[model samples]
Target chain A: DAGITQSPRHKVTETGTPVTLRCHQTENHRYMYWYRQDPGHGLRLIHYSYGVKDTDKGEVSDGYSVSRSKTEDFLLTLESATSSQTSVYFCAIRGDSFQETQYFGPGTRLLVL
Target chain B: AQTVTQSQPEMSVQEAETVTLSCTYDTSENNYYLFWYKQPPSRQMILVIRQEAYKQQNATENRFSVNFQKAAKSFSLKISDSQLGDTAMYFCAFGQVAGGGAQKLVFGQGTRLTINP
Candidate 1:
């Protein structure tokens, strides 16, 4: 898990409501990413942030948004959650040194009813 | 765009045996990275090994090694002297440096590996 921790590890929410997942890191890595894992799909990127206040979309960014206000916190929000959006979300961070590789958090399991 | 494929969905082997998991990727970019991730029942994504495209030498991590064929665009993981703790779902991933130098990863469907006693 490195220094990463995801809040609300398990969440049960209703469709059409809003949901936000938090990823906090203590090492202050320069890069952070959000991904979702599902059966037969392994894991797909949802969004990533290169630095504080700098963010971009990923392969499966639809229906989801991200915010990186501080270097330590990255948030992923489902403005209008749908049943199809139910999956386990993971957060990862890249070390500042030579393509060191990304370390992941424990992950958050979100179920939309 | 890059895509990673792990052809084997599941594999079973006895402890101390050797096994290989196949992974093929499609990508036009020459500068990239290849990785193998292991996820056990605990669901923790652990980094197994990685290979850089620019490097000609294959990557090895103790009991784990990779057979990377750059021309064929294939990267396979081989495990020797397997142990029961090695049983897990293994994912192959392709990585590229995105805008602002962020490395983005695309993963395969995953291969469930079981090491029997």
Candidate 2:
């Protein structure tokens, strides 16, 4: 809840549809991350950005893509939503210091049928 | 890749008592950070405590404290004077702090804790 907000907190979509989740931060932190939370998997990183226009893939980034055109906004996109992609997504941001703790947003619950 | 493990899937504690949650991690990096996060029923991820690998002193935040043993690769969270509101899912996470301080966290499966009054 650290001045971060995720759009479409709840969404129900159909398979094969495109879905995008937006994370906006007022903290102006240097790091932003996208993660998915499932029953067995507590949280898995999907994508992350270190700076504006700089992005990288994470352990579970295969089916996801991300973009950060600006420092305050990081976007995660599912090109073709699948049932497996249904889960609660979380966005987190960290300050520009090594000792800074990461803060999370509320979360977005995506359901695909 | 660094991996965090929270062995306890669930735990229970009575009000005003104490409970300890165990977490172990694997990391070859010498400089890193370990964190304990609490997720309430509302599903908000809140930071309970944090310890730096280089810091020999254990980290404490009010009733929450951590015992960090770098040699044992262990980091455990101890909650003193437990309250009903402490009932929640707790997750252990690890991250590497780069030169720019950019961080990416790797989390554990989480331990669900129930505090009964």
Candidate 3:
């Protein structure tokens, strides 16, 4: 285990509301990623952070944002929640180079009504 | 853009039997990595096996192994002596290293594997 945890394991929010999910890791990994899992789409990357204050957009970055102010914490925010954003969000950390395994935390299940 | 495809949406195998899951990926980059991740009912993604494109020999982990056919763009996972614990949603992923050592993964839709005991 890489000591990873995602807060608010399950959440329910109404449409147009603001919601933020948090991912905390104790491994001090330099790379952290956020992905959303849907029935037919599998897991699509939402956003990722390489280091403190450095982040980049992923394949499905629309309607989502991410910030990493510290090495241990990475946050994903949905500025205005929508029904399409309802899915399981997973957070993963890569401590080393490309060959290393990316450790994933228990996913956060979010439902937008 | 890189794409990973898993044609089989569901598969079943008897306990102690061997089963293989298929995965194919399309990528122009020569240097990359392929992986198989298992997501059990707990919803935690566990790495089953990984293969580096540069390696000619297949990679194996315990009862799990991968058949990497680079020319055919196919990566398949073989599980020997399957157990009930192996029942889970298996996902195939492709990772490409970008600038600054940031590697991003593209995953397949997943295959639901059931091990009947």
Q: Considering every candidate listed, which one attains the maximal lDDT?
A: 1
Question: Which pairs of residues collide in candidate 3?
Answer: none
* lDDT (Cα, tens digit) per residue for candidate 3, span A34-89: 99999987899888888899999999999999989999999999999999999999
Native interface contacts retained, candidate 2: 0.74
lDDT of 3 at A83: 99
Tell me candidate 2's TM-score on chain B: 0.96
lDDT of 2 by residue, B1-108 (tens): 888999999999899999999999998999999999999999999999999998999999999999999999999999999999999999999987543447878999
Give the TM-score, chain B only, in order for the candidates.
0.99, 0.96, 0.98
Tens-digit per-residue lDDT, B67-111, candidate 3: 999999999999999999999999999998864588899999999
Judging by lDDT, tell me the better candidate of 1 and 2. 1
Deviation of model 1 at B39, angstroms: 0.2
Among residues 3 or more apart in sequence or in different chains, the pairs in candidate 1 whose N, CA or C atoms overlap within 3 Å are: none
lDDT of each residue in B1-117, candidate 1, tens digit only: 788999999999999999999999999999999999999999989999999999999999999999999999999999999999999999999998897889999999999999999
Clashes of each: 0, 0, 0
